[model samples]
Target chain A: MLESIMHWWEKKQYRIAPYLFISPFYILFAIFMVYPICFGIYLSLHEWSGIGEMAYVGLENYLNLFKDGDFYLAFSNTLWYMGASLIVNLVFSLILAVLLNSALVKCKKLFRTIYFIPIVTSVVAAAIVFTLFYDRDYGLFNLLFVAMGGKPLDWLGDTSLSKFAVIGLIAWRWVGFNMVYFLAGLQSIPKSLYEAALVDGANSLQCFLKITIPLLRPVILFVMVTTLIGSIQIFDEPYVLTGGGPADSSMSVVIYLFRTGMEYLNLGYAAAIGFVLFGMTFVLSWIQLNLMGAFERKE
Target chain B: MKRTLLLILVALMIMVVVGSSGAGAQEEVTISMWTHDNLYVEFFTRRGEEWAALHPEYKMNFKFTQIPYDQLWPKILTTLAAGTGVPDLIGIEISAFSRFMKGDIAEQALVDLTPLIGEEKEKFLRWEPYMHNGKIYGVESALCPVVFYYRKTAFDEVGVSTPMETWEEFTQAGSKLKEKDRYIAAIESSGDTPHHFLALYYQQDGAIFNSKGELMAEDDPRAIQALQFLQEGVREGILWPTSSYFDAPHFAALKEGRVVGNYMADWWSVYYQKPQLPEQAGEWRIQLLPAWEEGGRRSSTAGGTGFAITKYSKNPELVFDFLHYTYMTKENQIKRFLELQYFPTMIEAITDPQITEFSDPYYGDQKVGKVFSEAALQIPVQWQSPYWSEAIQILYKEAITPVVADKKTPEQGLKDAISKIRALMK
Candidate 1:
């Protein structure tokens, strides 16, 4: 084996072949990906605005994290949003997917495209469109509410309702994509199982629970894990809509971190906040996997 | 060999012909100017036409962009950071000049215009704010000192006299209008809102960020007191509660004579209120802000941009010429400001007969020139540091607006803002 390895190394053609083939990825990755990430981490260790001399602060930035109450508020809000989106978006998507899967449904592709249109649309554009719908006095929703004798709400202004407004936006934008996943999962289930359930005097609900859900477990787990990650990183909608305002009531961890790093120029504290967010997400994902028996299913 | 020789001979002849043609031709230089709005394009084009008539050898190309105010600074900073493909001339906000000074990008990017100042220095009376380390880096386009424009009808109804001098009297008079179901003022607490909070802070002898770039006003008693004053209005339901600036409600309310007063720089007069309200004309009059203390300052300057030549400019002399022609000349500056309502920084134009004699139909025949000039002279010159933008955001977000909304206690809010400022300063 040693002699063959030595002979292979001696082969100039083979030696140059692998290097030439793989060099592009390594070179590009080093320059684009690895360098910036490492530089960002390094930047987090110092006190430098986008301009000026950087002062070496050691671990003071990380220490300041414990005292930063805004971080805690943002972190807690992130968890709250994740929980809300997971439950509401998942249930809505699952129910919609089931409804569309029924034989009673017509124009399947057209409906699918219509439902999927918002998901494909840019978040900035979608947020602007939703802003018009959520406007206070003259908005469509408020007009309808007023016609029904209900008072209009300051949708983006009131602290109590601001988070829900953002969650509503996120759910509306995302539920269709989740439904597509659920629909695909439902389609993969063989119709024979449902037919058998029907022959056994089982109702539609019974068939859904006993047969459809068990087989679609893998897809369900996939969606949950991805959604968990996505929800934790929520930024654009809240940033564009409320600007984390009405007194930072709707600020997310990513937005807070962005403010610290970019706007405030406190990269070190921002990095610490970033690490804390990373740890929380990682632990939560692990808990989810274990609780859902995801590992056991895969094994 | 013969065919190759013949080809070489033909190429040599072609090269000789091209060289002779190029030698006699003047070298045409194209200068790229990055500006915010296309509003200035016609002005610059008109100036370019004048410049070409004087000097036929050079061509000037203008590139104007209207980036969102929030986006413009960061984009410019990033381009400056990369040290490539930047415009030959750029405009920097007076409020944001300090931030650019702190960054290595602008230090190398800007041309030192000190030598160019000469007698033209008098053209800009408020030049100290845009200067750093005794070197002028930028030239002011407009003198944007803030003034109050009140509804004459509302004031008359409320029985308030012209030019209320003290904050107490101003607040008292504005409060009476509330009984008649009118807003005392349109309080804009929106994101990146500019009410010249820095000027207010300065008038009360408060500073946002100190020389060391640490937040100075966070723990200061005066800052908290200033915030509480605005909060009182909200609690009393005298000020508009919404966060948007000049939103539909604000506009509609003002149009219907429900808004008692509004505060903005001269730009608002030209760009918004005057141009939009032709029928409601002549019911508005301008005055300086009410003083906090009896002997305290009244006017605060808010927003303006200065033109600067980038180091990459090929013809720095020609760039200076354009700046002089548009900015320094009294005739051109006065024409532009009078036509555009930009409020020229030129001292000569401040008291020009054309300006003083002119009566705005929108302001009900009230003379605006004297009011603006008095306000401009009364403006408190504050240092525009690089950290001013960060300080403004913190002060507004954590202290001013939050206090106004009753979300945080004044002291607590200031503490949070100061602590954030301290962390940022590090």
Candidate 2:
């Protein structure tokens, strides 16, 4: 039997060994990722409370999700943060990345490490610190304002300002991480391109607009699309700080999904919310990619 | 390859078979419980440690775990939904209980506890929140009846006396104290419900959902009146705006005497004040909640927790027996109070001379237990639906907040909240 097994193994190893080597990941992915996603899609079509029989409701959950005012509110709030944060964060990170990649900049490693430190810090801890920073009476901003003879403003309490308060913390934690990606993109560009541009009649600004910008197009598009998706599905900062308050103005799509699925225990509806988010991210990313002509270039 | 695969499969099967078949009959019954309350775990775990070895019919191996309050709901929900990994026992908070009991999930996820509660049901102080459609699915270890907690120092300084009988008197006292820059109790226009809205609205003949299981907050005249009264107090500059009572800033304000009045449960004195504002000892006192009308009910239920046996539990009868042994008995209830400061839910425990005679230095030597016992027994029973959380979210954000922020009238806000909630239901 051992002789026969060894012979069979020797004959079949080339054909089946690679699949056997990678089988564990496939098995795990099927169970954890693919199955739940498929089950979630199935759940989106039904009315379920995470227990009992899943009542088939066809498109009812999705239909209701569309008409629900809170759904729209959460969507808009998420978009607001995404739009504002994306613009400021991208511009800031690009500047930092370019400066770090510059020839004159010394201690590039130290600067890179310092900028990336917050990205590695725990999100919850950072959010807690930001919460204290936004405290109405004792917060840093209000304390400074008070010292300057201005009244202390309610940062997390006011509806108009709370979203920004949450957004600021989000940007603070994420900008460094985004800059790392830009840094990689900056480093990847051949020095010859810049040297060639400089050698021509082009000045620094001309070289930048003509050479650096176009070469970094793929990376910029990559950063922009991912940032848009991540910011839209934001949950931790607002959840930990404002708890999607003072009037649900800071609630994002993921927060709504959490509230519906977990707080309300409406798993089916929450599943619908999730699918809607997926659809939204997909469509928006597609639109963004097309707008940027990301796919137009071979690179 | 086939022989090697077959050998591996056979070995795995044998291992699986050996692993699960180790337990025999007449073995110890182990029940695991999950909760967000730390003190409860400590008390129960100590009780189990001492008493577990004494059980003859079956040994007790009780495991109590404390999960974080916010994450507990999602953890419980996901486990219950997946129909696996559910603990033998779980505690659901009062404001959150309705969320679990909202739909068929209650029936499917919970072991029907009616048979266990039996004729002793009347002994429980407040349980309507743990029931759904005439079925009792859970039993609480503590009763958190809402009462008016005021700072004696502030009220004495303002020359306002205790035991205000009606809303008129309460508001008048608040307005009178406004002269000293100290207002009445602060009402929240944000954050979780059952903090301000639930306690006040349920003080009278008012409910978010009517007896017919209909959402009536927007149209229920009593609810509308309650919201209007709360908004008016804030508008009148009598009720201080400290946001939610649970927030850090509000806790600071409480210590600073910015808002010296609070609408809180009996547990707040021990669970919150003793821990968070210990320096304010000997200056706070508990009184009956002000009546909405003359001679009206002065008590309502706030945040508390009740343990429910999950349907996933294998030995529910055993789990139930252990639960009853630890919680339902009078001796243990009193012990629970002595150890954890949980306000006893059982009538006998509450009425015990040992309990009612308990005085608190924080309340200036007042018998805190007497207030809890009196108010606890008087808390009104109101039916609730699982959709209460969703409705409450809208009620707080769209309805109640707009009124308090002076952006909308109570009527308009309520109307909008109702419409918005109705849209969510669809």
Candidate 3:
């Protein structure tokens, strides 16, 4: 029996070795990601309170979600955040990346570290600081506005401006993150391309428009897709800052889902919301990629 | 031969160590608890030591974990679902209590504490929130009777005497304060929860749900009246429209004397006011909440927490004994009051001299405890419903904000909120 086992092991070691080496990641992915996705689908079809027996309710949760006014509000708010963050973060990060990539810039490392600090800062600590800064009465923003003879604005209280308040926080934390990606993309572009454009008597704007942007398409698409995903699922900034308040004006889809599942104990409804969010994210991302010509022939 | 002898000697040593540890484990009863508040952990730890000392035969090993408020409930629920890693005991906040009682989980996940509490149930000031289907699930932590906290200096400046007695008088005092560019109280216009509204509503016998857990906010005329009172107060600029309470803007407003009055539970004085506004010592005073009618209910319960034993506990009886000795006993209840300023739910403890006669210098050397204890007996019950969290969210969004913003009348706003909540219930 020992000889037979040894013979089998010798025969299969080469084939099994590779699987053993890569099995950890696949095992973890199955347990965490795949299992959750499957379970979420099953949960969406049931009525559960997270602790009790799940009663299968078929498509009721989804049907209810379709008519849910709060869900629509949260959906619209999340789309607004996605569009705003994508534009604000991408534009600011691209500008910073271009400036930092320029030879005219000095102390590049120091500037990079300074700009990156907010990304590394604790969201809770940053939120506390921002709360003080956004205070309607004594906030720094209002204080400065008042000094400049402008009316004091309720950064977080007003329903119209609460979304912008959250957007500002999102921009502050994420601009640096996207900037790093753009910086890498800029560095990867050969210096010869810019030199050739310069030799051809193209102005800096022309060179940037024709050469730099075209070369950075992949990175921009990557950033746009990520920013879209991140903004749609935003929970921390709005949660810690405005708490999706002033009448759910700043409520994000993830915050709504969290409130449904954790706070209200509507696990089935929350799971339905989650799947809807996933579907929305997938459709948006696909459309975004298609618009960026990511699926076109690469040759 | 020497190697074999060495192995035997090592095995003997391992056996001794393992045997000793096994004996120790057999003697010790490990009890684990989870709470969101560190203060509770300290209270429990102190009580645990005393309990252990009193019961020397049963060696107790207590483990207390303090989780963040937002994360703790999810953790507890997940553990309860998995039927593993659940603590022997849990501290359930009053707001989250409804979530736990929804569906069959209340019975499956928690021990029926009714048997343990038995006749002692009558001794608690409030048990409605922790009770479900005629069975108690948790031990009440506080009476949480709401009181009106005001700045004496601000009131004196406006010539408003103590105990405004009626909401009409309170509004008049607010108008007086408004002339000096100050507001009497801060009304939260965009608060995440409808605490201000709920407190006043409950004071007038308004409840979101009836005792039978039926939706009744729309039918409750007092709820509309309470909401209109807030809207009118804000419209007249007599009440400051704060973004939220216990925040930077609210504290800044308080410090600058832009707002003076605050209505909250007894714990607010010690937990938030004294600690947050220590410089305003001796300037604050407490009184029963102003009644809607001249002699109506002056106090309403706002917030509370309860300790409960989990069904998964290996020794639930032991846990109950510990809770009874600490929370149910009058002596420890008074101790909790003196140490933590968490007004006790124990009826006997509410009238104890140590609790009622205690004076706080922060509130102008007033017998703060006495005022709260007096109100404790009159605190209106806050019934729990599965739709509570959703209802509060809807109440703030569809009702309070639109009403306060003058986009809708109180009647219209509340009607909309009720219809929305009812739709959700379907």
Top TM-score model: 3
- C-alpha displacement of A146 in model 1, angstroms? 4.9
Model 1, residue B266: distance off in Å is: 2.1
Number of the top candidate by lDDT?
Answer: 3
Model 3 lDDT tens row, B1-426: 999999999999999999988776547799999998888899999999998898877778999999998999899988988889999999998888888777857788899998888887887778788888878888877778999999999999878887789999999999999999999998788775678899999998888988888897875789889889989999999888877677878887888999999888878877878878999999999999988887798898788898899999999998999989989999999998888888988888899898889998888899988998989988888888877888888998998887887888999999999998998777
If ranked by TM-score, best first, what sequence of candidates would result?
A: 3, 2, 1
Could you give candidate 1's per-residue lDDT for residues B311-381 as a string of tens digits? 76778877888877877788877877767777778888877877666667678777787788777776765
Evaluating just chain A, the predictions reach TM-scores of: 0.91, 0.90, 0.94
lDDT of residue A49 for candidate 3: 92
Docking model 2 quality class: medium
**DockQ numbers for every candidate?**
0.32, 0.50, 0.73
Model 2: how far residue A37 lies from native, Å: 2.6
- Top-DockQ structure, candidate number: 3
- Selected candidate, larger lDDT, 1 vs 3: 3
Put down candidate 2 lDDT per residue, A1-299, tens digits, no spaces: 99999999999999999999999999999999999899899999987776667789999888888778788999999989899888867998899998988989999999989988988898889877887788786579999999999999878878888898987887888778888998998889898988888888789999888888888888899889888988878998899888898779888889999998888877889999999898889999999999999668675
Clashing pairs in 2: A50-B81, B102-B386
